[model samples]
Target: MLINIMGFLVSYVFCLIITPLISKLALKLNAVDIPDHRKVHVKPMPRLGGLGVYLAFIIGLIVIGFPIMSNIQVILGATLIVILGILDDIYILKPYQKLIIQFVAALVVVYGHVSVDFLYLPFIGTVDLSVSIIPITVLWIIGITNSINLIDGLDGLASGISFIIVFVFVILAIINQQDTILMLSFVLLGSILGFLYHNFFPARIFLGDSGSLFLGFMVSVISLMGLYKTVTVSSLFLPVIILGLPLMDTFLAIFRRLKKHQSVMAPDKEHLHHQLIKFGLSHRKAVLLMYMLSATFGIVAIIFSKAILWGTLLFSLLVIFISHYFYNYNFNKIIHFLNRKYNKT
Candidate 1:
């Protein structure tokens, strides 16, 4: 407990101290985001803020005395992810280039023996993946990595959502008594909160591709370490629920693009956040609403973790119904009406 608190504080302070330096370096290196048609920010902002987050997390691990050898592969893969992000932030790498790097990094993590070998389905009992674990792990890492990046639409949006998700992971880790995962979750949550202080509305700096990609990679890895270790089918569903919003957004984006006969990687302004903005929510409100939605999913995951098989099924159905109804029936009108009512009051 003491060490976990120390890890969180060390990461928080490190990010607080390092982010300003990174901001200056980003400006000096001309690595800044310029406002464009698909962007929300009106001014050029320094990026590479992920450098601070990555450094702070590494330092926190060192401070916690975590075994270097045990995490060598994750560190190596994360290094590759950070490098890819830096290059993308600087030169705007093509989607294929970024995808190749992601695949290589995923391979390195898998090679380090972090593959999902089996699953415990509700009625079917244990199902072995055998060789199929390789592709499954790779696909999960890449999918999560891009899901996070795709949702980096608003200031503090990605980092804030990530912080919430990590917070839930921390709770789940405590419940499961996974010490290593608990420590990692604390450090990640602290680092993201530190970064969010500056990256929030009217942001001072951006996480760039580097921060988002690194965060996505770490989140996926941590979920595997903690949640995916369980034998129950609910274990498989936990991550999907915890990361529900971003995964849904990513899939919707791909489907939307496919229907339009466009490349799945093409940039656009039709994301969930954009749709909320179109529905009369301000930027901060939209982000806050998304945070609430993510937290709702997190709560569902927590309940599902403790539920029996029948209870899990019921909870899952409730979640799907509520989510669909919230979006389809009352999302815009309710929020807008509330805003108006509150303003008038």
Candidate 2:
């Protein structure tokens, strides 16, 4: 355990020390996200921040001496995402093209047998979802990828969320006594923290599509392994509630798009960060608040996992209610009022 932790830390420091240099190179290459009316930031910031994270992650894994797997599906899936994202960063691929790439990556994970095979329903017994697990797992992977991608609008947003999730996964893995996942989480956590050095506030570089998709895929795969690796799904709620921020963001985005009759993949400025900014929060403050929200859910998940079913149920509802109260900052009301006034003509 200690050795695994050490390997992760060594790679983490390696990543941290090199992150600024990566940002500098990104800037020099003009791989920056330029400002637009819909964008929160007002400057040109270099992107493809995922490259450093991916490089550091792979280096950490190799250093940890687990490069080869029985099937190597996770490695291949993540690599595909990185390549697809890198290409999109350079050439700005069409939405369809990007979706196709994402689907392909999910397919690798699904067919590679790294998917969630069943839901270990608490008390209700094991729910065999094998026959339909493929489609469900694909959607889960693809949805999570896009969720993280869209949530990357704010500096430090996606990185911070990834940090929160991986941290929780590490803890869960330890409790479950899943040595492989526990070690994997350490390396992942370390690598992500290394990226945060450059990805944090007053960001030097954006993660672009590559980093977000890579992160989303990793979180999905790792969580599945943590909870579904065995014959039971006794603690699936932990990951779901723990990932409240991204899941809620994804849920809201889909509903908002559907309501507007827009394509689910339609780009917009109505993300969680954008709403917070509209409510007069600074970028730093908004991101920090989100971090706090993420931390709260993470901590609650840990506590909930140790509680009884009824107790966990109550705790989950309380978290949701609190989230609802705080998240409703009335941005939609403002938009509606403005639309009404303008449409009076």
Maximum-lDDT candidate: 1
lDDT of 1 by residue, 1-345 (tens): 899999999999999889999999999988899999999999999989898999999999899997768879998999899999998888899999999999999999999888777887888988898869899999999999999999999999999999999999999999989998898889888899889998999789999999999999988888877787788869768899999999999999999999999999999999999998887888998898899999988998888899999998888788779778876886678878966875688
Residues 1-345 of candidate 2: C-alpha lDDT, one tens digit per residue: 886788689668877877777677777766678898788788888787888888888888788786448538888989999999878876788989988988898899887787777775666867888788888888878877787888888889998998898888888778878877877778878888888888888887888877888898888888776766654333667667778889888889989999999998888899888887786666787788788878988988788777776776677688779768855866567545644564575
* TM per candidate: 0.97, 0.89
Task: For model 2, state the Cα shift of residue 171 in Å.
Answer: 0.6
Q: How far is candidate 2 from the true structure (C-alpha RMSD, Å)?
A: 5.9
lDDT against the true structure, per candidate, is 0.90, 0.80
Model 1 regions more than 4 Å off? 341-345
Mind sharing the TM-score for model 2? Answer: 0.89
